[model samples]
Each structure stands twice: as structure tokens, then as C-alpha cells.
Target: MGFDGPTFAFHPDRRAQLRAELDAYYARLYGLIRDELSYILDPADVMGDDYPSETFRVLKNNELREFW
Candidate 1:
């Protein structure tokens, strides 16, 4: 069985909100990663060279498709 009710619809305003939220979420995640890893690695170097794509992959693999 699966969900069978009034499904949520995505609207433009909601899309904008989600985008902002996602940006902030990633920014915070980056900040935390940087702060914790500074002693072992260069945050800017890791983020610039690898983080974006890796983050995208993790999100996709985890099926993080909804934001509220």
C-alpha cells in the first residue's frame, strides 16, 4: 500500500522557500564541516573541489525530495 490522500502540490512560492532553505542548510553544513575539519583539511579546498557534487549525490541517494 501507499499514500492515498490529498497529495501536496509544489507551487512557485513554495519552490522559492525550499530553495532558500536548501541554500541555508548547505551553508550550515559547510560551516560545520569546515569548522570540524580545519585542523585536518582545508575547508575551501574540499568544498570547491568536491562538496557540491558529493552533497547532491548524497541527497539524491537518500531521496531527500521534500522540504517544508
Candidate 2:
């Protein structure tokens, strides 16, 4: 079976828009952590010593899927 509809079309512009929005969201989140939370807790301690991989793991984990 096949489907035909305007919604089925691939939209690069929409994809770019979403990507930009996601980047902005993360930038704001990190900015808040740096400005406000850094005084109370070291970002390294909160994020652990290995931050990039740990952050990726937390984001990709199943438990966060629902929240996302």
C-alpha cells in the first residue's frame, strides 16, 4: 500500500527550523546552568568528569524518552 498527501513530503526547511529551535533550547538551558547553578554546584560535579558521553547517555536513555 501507498499513501499520498502534502504532509508526506520531505521538508528541509522545517527540519532546519526544528534543528535551530533545539539548539537554542539547549543553549538557553546551559546558559542558565552556567549563570545560576554554577555558584551552588560545580558543573563538572553535576555533569560528572566525563560530561559529553554522560550527557549523551542521559539524553538517549529510555527513561528520558517520555520526558522528551
Candidate 2 accuracy as lDDT? 0.55
| Candidate 2 per-residue lDDT over residues 1-68, each given as its tens digit | 76665566667678668866776677687775543443233344566666543434554365346535
> Scored by Cα lDDT, where does model 1 land?
0.56
Per-candidate Cα lDDT values, in order, are: 0.56, 0.55
Each candidate's root-mean-square deviation in Å?
8.3, 9.0
**In lDDT terms, which candidate is top?**
1
- Which ranges in model 1 have alpha carbons more than 4 Å from their true place? 32-68
Question: Clashing pairs in model 2?
Answer: none
Q: Which candidate is the best by TM-score?
A: 1
RMSD of 1: 8.3
Candidate 2 minimal-lDDT segment of 10 residues: 34-43
Q: Write down the TM-score of every candidate.
A: 0.40, 0.34
Deviation (Å) of 46 in candidate 1? 18
